[model samples]
Target chain A: MTTPTPRANSGPSGTSDAPAVPAVPGPLAALPDADPAARERLHARLVDGAERAGLLDVAYRTLETPVGPLLLAATEEGLVRIAYGVQDHDAVLADLAERVSPRVLRGPARLEQTVRQLDEYFAGRRTRFELPLDLRLSTGFRREVITRLPDIGYGRTESYARMAAAAGSPRAVRAVGTACATNPLPLVLPCHRVVRSDGSAGGYAGGAEAKRTLLTLEAA
Target chain B: MALRPFEEIVTEYGPMVLRVCRAVVGPHDAEDAWSETFLAALRAYPELPEDARIEAWLVTIAHRKAIDVVRADSRRPLAVAEVPEPAVGGSGTGGPGAPAASANGQAQQPPWERDEELWDALKALPRRQRAAVAYHYLAGLPYREIAAVTGVSTDAARRAASDGITSLRRSLPGRTEQRTDAGARQRRAHQREERGERP
Candidate 1:
């Protein structure tokens, strides 16, 4: 207690009623240990209620895809962020809390359609993503580049220089690479389609290995 | 600076809120109280003032939810499940809970529901005293904040906590005798009983 407590055991517990508040916090500091199972159950219930009430500012869930575990997050606007394992899921959520809304919570229902589309893409049954996206994190030339990413088409690669030309910045080839490397919605946006001009796989935010995996999966 | 995600708030303060809820509503309904408190917190989290006392804010929400759970519980008196504190320290597993449960055929009690002598003592106190002790001792809220929470004057909050702890010590002084494990103390008290010694 910030206020100095009266001396403990003021002449024992002899006189009942109005003894000093225990001078030390030791008496009750050892509260019962919580059951982890109970915590999880309550947390999930809270998430469900928050989601239904529209208080879940950013709901997220992860999916194990061929590329790796992808962290999908959404706002009331639509799907806002999809981070690769290489991007660090924790840091990605924190960024969303800063860039989107601080009221982030983990509720999978909001991302169900996004997860289905990602699964179909990984399984080779889907060639294009139809999910609504929130790309507010991007701006200016970079935003323009990623906005045009879906035009590259599935299973087809485009030269970075060509992407720059397509994005109305023919000389911004390096900017195109920068945009692709930072594509907040990577696989769904088809940043993987933006390749090195020499027909080789290029640097990717999901790591070069992940880039190879996505390309190989699509090639088959 | 950006406000922290609500999930972090839950992680940091959830257990403490649960403890406060348990003291106010007992274990059986504490989870329900906890769930309701946090759901309400999450709903209004967007507007929570940045300088608000996070713990006190949570305790305030918890205080209200605890009242709701208690009111709902009162309707089902038979289901209130008031297990009496054992006469002396004994394991919850083999303590007086079994005989007591047998009488009600509630022997199949959930593990978490058994043997909280501290909660029992806190439960026995008057409602305001229990809340004052909880928000002050368990949650470490100052009497002014406790006054804000329990709607009492600052001096009254301080009085309620003192009176509450006075009764708590009378009820379970041995529970606080040693800073060591309560289980160890109970087992020692039980072992002393096993030898027919004056415990």
Candidate 2:
């Protein structure tokens, strides 16, 4: 594939002998021996630079999932990312990288196994995601809300107010609405299973249609 | 129920916008800036034309916030220079007047410097060009998104990035030189690690 022209501002010209990086527009691969701190610092510069330029829509990636593809988006700040795949791959990925964090990489290798397990679940062979996810995206409240969800057992659902009360914000039905709205990682956390107090679908970041489809699949 | 403009925008553009904020400001500031940027967008949504690029518009707002932070940081007071005693209150014995002070009596300490030539080179770019480079190269905005945000045609955004690159090339040091120096440093660090390992 033809490489995109190197940005004239590319980091210092190393020996021309070094293999030129190809412009394959997949998830960013790991940098060799990457210092996590340096990577974070450099990513911050990029995010800051982009912010200074006033470009906000975050960029994200779609990992193939059993129910469907999963979207994972993050900001350059920390890993408190969001996931909402099952539609519009290009737009979602672009938004994630641009707005969330340009330092996006493929999800941990274990996610692939998780994806497989999810596929098996859809195939009626497995039931839960056992892979390690970098759930650094959720806040304490959101995390508490979501963490309570997977324990919600497959084929079951909970009400928003109940989730709020369960998360120790018993007076926060509105707050529950917000927590669901801002659920960084959606399906993995199964925010879709959270419904309105009236037992109707309240809202979902991935569109109500997708949410319904997911709920239906789980119910099946 | 129809998605509110705020929800729609957040669903559509939240991650990328947050990324940009996270990049420039820290993670802490990113959420506030993100909330503000969209809140502003929501208020202005009705005014947007159908042809208007919403993502571009959102990004431009985020950039403004980043610039505001930068400008605010610039306003902090400089540390007072500890100038040597003005000998006027001193005995005539030529006591060490501390290090020599400038004619204005400020201490001659090395100008508190960032020595950030690379950052300086980036800063030297024209505003739009610089923005284009930062967004495209660093923030990794595609040309189309960059175009959408800058209110420029896509081709124009591409050119801005290209031109910004050209300008930065002229201003910044060569990449090859950096690679060489980095290689040397890596080698030294490796050698030191090896020496420690040998024991």
Candidate 3:
């Protein structure tokens, strides 16, 4: 640790018996006690005010589930991205910053309705989500595939080839598979509903095990 | 590497920036300065370089925000010069010298609630010296980066920090001893860690 170097070169020469100056604490270490809860409340208010004033372009929060932590993010449009823990939450936020906007904050209050609905879904009370979604992260065929997913209905599964045909590209089975693998919004958009043509569950963005968990939950 | 979430950045650096703000502008204006600094940083975070030193970046933003606060203060109507005596009991409302209540009815604690002597010593330093000490000692910025932020030469930055520390030592003799004792305790703890002993 670099002790603050004393003023050895400058200042009037002192006699040898002068008391030594104590080391200054680091800037952060020197602060008076702050109420963390108050600060958090203050930040939430700031973010909300900023968002309302059109200064904040993105807001995000994490939600806990039986599976693990899920990163939920939104744009001015609506809920945009959802990533499982395995997707690396930090990387997902960086992607949102690059793709959506850098003005992102952890304003959980903005996601209150979304989280409440999600909690209801997880608790097996809600059968559908009525939240607004921003699908700008997906484009072209992928967007079409994601758009078609909700139509597969809750508790129903679809084969990739059949889903590809439903997406207006019957021969684009591989493309549909690619779409599911890279869906920016997973559980909320229901990418786990797509399986292999043989009825074996295919890959999922949240990893194969998470996909299994979601499927089993829906089947029950 | 990609930039982490702005939320993570806030969690990691908020306290440090808050401390810097309070030290530079006093507790009265610290919260506003902090909020402005972060709001500005968030607006530009996407374009920040991948490997940029986040602490330095935040300090630079904080320096600019603190200047803005100072400018705004200069434009405000002057308050009476009398300093309030410290309060005797625990009170949320700031004592006589407390900051005016915020718009939301939040009563910010007065400087006396903390180390008044140290805060007074800090506030008495010349602006350059105060900034230098806060950036170097508080924020841990090197003289080179401090120079960049303060627009002073590196040598000047170092001199200002040194001068500031000297002034503080003179003003708060009792507190200086406490800091020294704390430093010694920390050193002992580090030594214990090196020896694989529990601190």
The true-versus-predicted C-alpha distance at residue A220 of model 2, in Å, is 1.7
lDDT of 2: 0.52
**Per-prediction fnat:** 0.30, 0.02, 0.23
lDDT of 3 at A188: 80
Candidates 1 and 2, the one with greater TM-score: 1
Clashing residue pairs in candidate 1 are none
Q: List ranges where model 2 is wrong by over 4 Å.
A: A1-68, A72-82, A85-101, A106-110, B1-199
Tens-digit per-residue lDDT, B115-184, candidate 2: 2454456556677776675565434555666777777987788788778767765665343221222234
Q: What is the TM-score of chain B in candidate 2?
A: 0.44
Q: Residue-wise lDDT of candidate 3 within B163-187, one digit each (tens)?
A: 8777765665434222433333334
How far residue B52's Cα lies from its native spot in candidate 3, in Å, is 4.0
For each candidate, report its DockQ versus the true two-chain complex. Answer: 0.18, 0.03, 0.20
Clashing pairs in 3: A27-B138
Question: What are the per-residue Cα lDDT tens digits for candidate 3 across A1-220?
Answer: 3243334332223322334422344332346434474366446645855675676777888999987899888877889999999999888888887777767787776688889998988888877789889999999999999887888788899999999899888999999999988888887888899999888998988888888998888888
Locate the minimum summed-lDDT window of 10 residues in model 3 chain B.
Answer: B80-89
User: Which CAPRI level is candidate 3?
Assistant: incorrect
